[model samples]
Target chain A: MASTTLQGLPASPGIAVGRCWTVDRRRLRTPRRKVTEQEVETELDRLDVAIDLSVQQLDGVRAKFQASDGAEHLAIIDVHRAMLRDPSLVDEVRRLVRVERVNVEWAVKRAVRKIKGAFDADDEFFRERRSDVDYVGERIVKNLMGQGSDAAEMPPPGSIVVARDLSPADTALFFHDRRVAALVTDAGGVTSHTAIVARALEIPAVVGTGKASTSAERGDWLVVDGSHGLVVLNPSAAERAEYEAARVRQMEREAELTRLKDLPAETVDGVRLRMVGNIEFGEEVPGLLSHGGEGVGLYRTEFLFMGRSELPTEEDHYRDYRALLDAMGGRPVTVRTFDLGGDKLPSGQKDHSENPALGLRAVRYCLRHPDLFYAQLRAAVRAAAHGNLRIMFPMVSGVAEVRAAKWALAEAFEQVVAQGLPARMPPVGVMVELPSAAVVADRIAREVDFLSIGTNDLIQYAIGVDRQNMDVAYLYRPLHLAVLRMLKSVAEAARAAGISVSMCGEMAGEPLYTLVLLGLGLDELSMNGPSIPEVKRVIRGASAREGRELLDRILDLNTADDIEREVRAEMARRFPGLLEGGARVGPVSG
Target chain B: MGRLERSFVIVNSLGLHARPAAMVVQASNRFRCEIQFEKDGLQINAKSIMGVLTLAAARGASVLVICEGDDAEQAMAAIGKVFESGFGER
Candidate 1:
């Protein structure tokens, strides 16, 4: 058969040439028969039994996958478990059975529809949540129908999975089962929970294909090119040969990068550079180490505080920090104080502002709640005795905020000392994220031991563009002259103060920007663990002087397009295969 | 015991979504009270997932919780704690 190629969003990057395994999640047809008054009691019993069974099934799934998948995946199960035990759903189903005098399956279907209908269709989060509610309803309906809960079987190992859409629970199961090679979904965007989980699991995925499930048949030879977001079905002989060669080359490049794990991340000119990993959980330590990470540059401590009922006490913080520090084997771990607010607000913390991004968050939130901030500081201080630990505050606009935060940290230190706890004071630093922080970096640098430029927020704030908003995404340029100037100034400020400056943002991880960052005189680059080897390869290939020269030439450019063109051309010339997907340099532009 | 009521803003990033709704349900189940959560002009059984979800309370939305039973005060306090803690999602 002739080859047919489908285009979709590249949710993850890689090439998976495998047979197609289509997952058909057609909703089960419920018998909509009305029940007699006498049969109502029996139907109610069946509904209760179904709900109980679904909850048990979810618990079993959660238990089986909890050890392998970590908190994010387990959280999805937690949501499902919560949905199963949701009193509203339970009460509604019961009421529907009693009031509507319907079969258990019919009652479940109706109640799910009613609840889902209440959600605003315009809101994307609620829309996705509607699917989650439907997934739970289906589970209960299946149980009520006496059907096997495990009917959605795992695909054959290493087969490309084609589905209409995958719920978070299904994604977890597929991820833990390790049977699927790649995922092609008819629905979901890059920001969807499924896509996020796919990227976390390191699985190649092309989502929002809209027709992958219908176009591809079972056992068909499918090539899922996640980098280009192309799914080729029944590939021609020539196409297959080309893809096979590309796959081999990709594998060789990966192996070569892996071999550099134990080597120092020094440039060709012998300028020593530090490559650190940006992590959220302690479980990522092994992966980070395997990627040649010298230390943890950015350990986001917000995870410990989030998704829990109570604030993380000193002991809670200390335990987590201690475990992470122990796993790092004395490598420095810079723990950034809770960067909560914006999208990271804890439940029940209402963000009524029109613009949450620029609203009170991060250091501002901590400043308002000194008690909560001190608890975290105390934990970091107590855990410092375990290994090298550094505490940094996020969104510090000026020296006063830094001083205030340090004052709170000092109080925590005093409290720890009073208790005669084994506490050590780590170097406290400030993240130069906001434009105010960047403009006054010289002053902030003098007050802190180190400065880490969070370019993700820095660029957004400097350029006055919301990165998450697609309409203004074009304005979120990393190579923009304003951004380059901000980064250069921050680095220079840290240098003038004899303080170390590192970049722990999206810019640090991309090979396209590795040269620019090194050229700009950043002492360290901390990024996602998996991107370390490829970035290290680029660092090992060039000299700091060359990077500085490139930076100089690019800094003179007037527009982002010109800067991008020059950089991409230079990157392609220097490192051929590094800039995959043709001229596209990074995973996402800005 | 008398009817006890308290108002709390849904602070969790997801608001009165499934997980938080479930948490509210679990907290309310601890008491013998008939608990109801009122939000956006609609009131739901605080212990019911469907009821809470139907409220469609987004982040920053305020929910008024009422309980009437022998442990009404305790139930109100416990449920209030769930909202206060952002359902452990902060």
Candidate 2:
């Protein structure tokens, strides 16, 4: 066998080395037409029944998860319900079958396209996971008009889950059966349910593997290494052995991490570091807490933007946030007001610039959509009373944004009080993601109770290295002195303002950079839920004094190159592969 | 064809996500037949549990029902309604 690689947004959990089972969602067939007037009524009734069945189908899937997750999966299901209930669908079906006399499949397709057009124009997050909704809608419209059921045979669980894209319905089948590992799909974003679940399952998934199966046969040996997001087909014996060893090493490292699952973060030097996690959704709650996260450090509220056909309403935000807070008990959960823009914005946003990283997002989107923003603020305020909740604004670079967000938050608190809902003042914080924010962080820190140096964005914004571009992705380094300098400034500013500061970015998770960050006099460190234990253990090994000493040395370095060399030397002497894959930094900034 | 009676359980932990529900619905719609799901002695027209679930099918329970109509016999065979009854489901 030979070796090759395919890259895609990683999603979902578990690993499998099986034959590919691709579900071609695009090859959807519509319902049929009637030959007689008598048939027209019968067909309409049949179409209605079919559509009803399809809608009910979604309801059933939603019901399945309702026990474990109450009404969470209903976002997309509700949208399908809307499609089923849409009066226009009946009109369109009649027009196609009765007027155009097109086959049921064709008619259904046209009707679905018309409906999809509305959802497409809806918003950014909805645009991401709408295909699942559309697929369901297509099935309903087709059946209503008399198109027979389109059923794709699921390959055995031992088979690799291959698809153009997968919906949560497709993922649910793998609840306990772990054989379906390593998903390969032709389509999806990193945030897609399929992709998210893949990563959660720890499966080696290579999505956007466009026509990957064309490269080999069903029986031919292939290696799907989802960690590096690679797929090596027909590898030489040497390459196979090499990968086999690498896989074993990977598994051992994972096992080691799992051992720290219950251990508290205590340094040998008797320092206890705050080890928090990033929670994007409630499903992440168990995993995050299971990994020993003290609590949620950064909850990207932009997640509401994913799935379904419409924007999440105030009640939706309240319910979702409330549920998460309830799950966390007393653990502090920092809710980052949507930090979207760049490629992450809902596709519906207008005139989206190429450099969206430097464009309007987070507070900007909130400010523009005041009603939705205020509703979310109220939700957070209410949820705060349930647990140790903190409200944070993303993409803040100026004093005005902080003041404005705070003002809105105050109003939200007042409204919640008026509504007689339990409320608490969520500690207000800002993500120091932009250079402007970091540079003037001291003054900004004065306005807020806390600051989180988002070194991923800070480093990218400072060095002007696009972390995503593979060509320059190599240039994305964390230990760069400028970034350290910025961190120093934010830390100093927060200290001056008497406000605590934390970091919830990729760099915060790196053991080598941990000392440098601590050295800078940071108060808290939040990282990937999985890294919390070891990073905390590393912190325990060093006193705040030792970290401060390391910080002092790292601060004096002038170049990114020097910063990288010193970190590699120190960390190599300490731990290997600690700073390996983590962009030496985090997200590429402006 | 005589209406043949048979049962299938919903093996999936979640009885019917929208897609699967729709799949079962579509499957039932294909045969010139009538399908109903029965659980706890309460018969639910397989067509609508948007009623039966107001009855609540707990994860582990026995549910029995069958298909009736022109092609009810064939529809009863492939439909996994029996699986939904939690037949040995973990």
Candidate 3:
């Protein structure tokens, strides 16, 4: 049979070959109708019953996951349950039924649309939230139409599930079934809830394919190359043979990575490197350990302040830090202070900037709120007694901010000491994210104990591109000469000052950049927990001398494409099959 | 009828989203008063999720809760507690 391929955004990395199973969500549609004044009471009653049914369905789903101990999944169900019982939604539908004399279905749809319209802001976080609201509306609508949850139609085992979009609830059902080979959706980005759950479940997934459901037929032999976002339908003999070979290679690579987990992260030339994990939630510790993470390089403290109504007290910060430190088992943990504002602005903060990316955020926010900063510092000082705890400040532009931060930290140390709490002064570091910090790195490095380069922000800021904005996302080039120069300069400054230097960014996680980073003289590389083994394999394969030679040759290149091509060729030649459709090298802005 | 009101800033990173909005509605329903939430000059029924969500109150956005009825004071206080505790998110 002739092979046809569909391209999409790679939401999760892996490959799966199975029969296609298209989940028909057409049953969720509700019919529109008009209601008379006398029918208002009946419409309201219908709305109530639909809501009750939706809630009951969600409760049952939650119960199924309750035994699996997946807190994140249960939390998502709770949110859906809350939405079902939301009085504002219920009252709005009832009012619409009476005032507009509309059917319960139309009223519910209108109410949900109104809420979604409000959430259609420029912020990515809020935009992503609209999906949850839409999901709840669909659930209620489905229930109102006397349709059961779509989980009833279980796809055959090892089938690739295709859908227009899969909600968290739907993803949870698939997760429990444990028979889904992969997921392909017509809608959803890499950050979607479906993608996140798919990654957690380790299922191969390709999302945002606009027409994956319509183009592919059910029961077709499909090959989902999730790493490359390619789906081959009715693959020919040659295509199947190629995919089979690729699958075997991928499995062998994975097994090799697992075997290297217990081995030390060192270059072939005997240069030992520290590979740490960047953690936002404490729950990721076990995964970090399994990935052979040496320690926590970047523990974002903003999460504690996030999803809460008030500032976290000193005790709150201390308890979280202490728990994390204890879990690391004496390995050094560097915790960055609340790098709030910008995209991560806490609810209720006024966004006064036309461009928040360049506005007062991170260190600036902390400087303005000294009391809040001091509370976190006091906690870190107290938590230092638990294990090796290091405090770092994010988005520091110059030495003044570092000194001011140090002054605040000293005050916190004194306050903690006065209270007779077990406190100790830990080493303080600054994230060299801004070009200003990188340029003046020598002066800043002199003021701090260490420097951790945040390449994600550094690349975006230096290139003047918002990585999340797809139109201009291609301009966010990590291999841009300016970026490389800034990184090199920062590493040199850290070396000159005899201070430790590390990079905790998305770049550090990609195997394509591992050699270049080491060659550039970065002392440590911290990334997401899952990427450790693959990166370690690269480290273990190449000598630092070869990396330095490759870096020198690539530094003379003018364009990002040239640099990328050179790096890819060298990596492929040295480590065969390592870069074989595995590492996504270019246009990776986010 | 007596009227009582209080202002609160959403502290949760997600602001008056689904779960918190539900808490606000649940708290408002406990009293006989008619409760309304006002944000950015937009007023909405505190007991209505659709209404509260339409305000799109983000973290650090201020919201005013007003209750008018015999149980206005109690309703206002109960709503205040929900915001104060961050709907148990903190």
Give the chain A TM-score for each candidate: 0.66, 0.62, 0.67
- What tier of docking accuracy does candidate 1 attain? acceptable
How far out, in Å, is residue A14 in model 1? Answer: 3.3
- What TM-score does structure 3 among the candidates reach? 0.69
Candidate of highest TM-score: 3
DockQ of each: 0.26, 0.02, 0.33
Quote the positional error of residue A9 for candidate 3 in Å: 3.6
Task: Report the interface RMSD that candidate 2 achieves against the true structure, in angstroms.
Answer: 14.0
Quote the positional error of residue B47 for candidate 2 in Å: 3.3
Q: Deviation in angstroms for A346 in model 3?
A: 13
Per residue, candidate 2 scores C-alpha lDDT tens digits across A403-486 of 999999999999999999999998999999899998888789879989987878777888899888889887777777677777
lDDT of 3 by residue, A441-551 (tens): 999989999999999999998998988999999999999999999999999999999999999989999998888987987889999988999899899988899888988
Chain B vs. true chain B: TM-score per candidate: 0.93, 0.63, 0.94
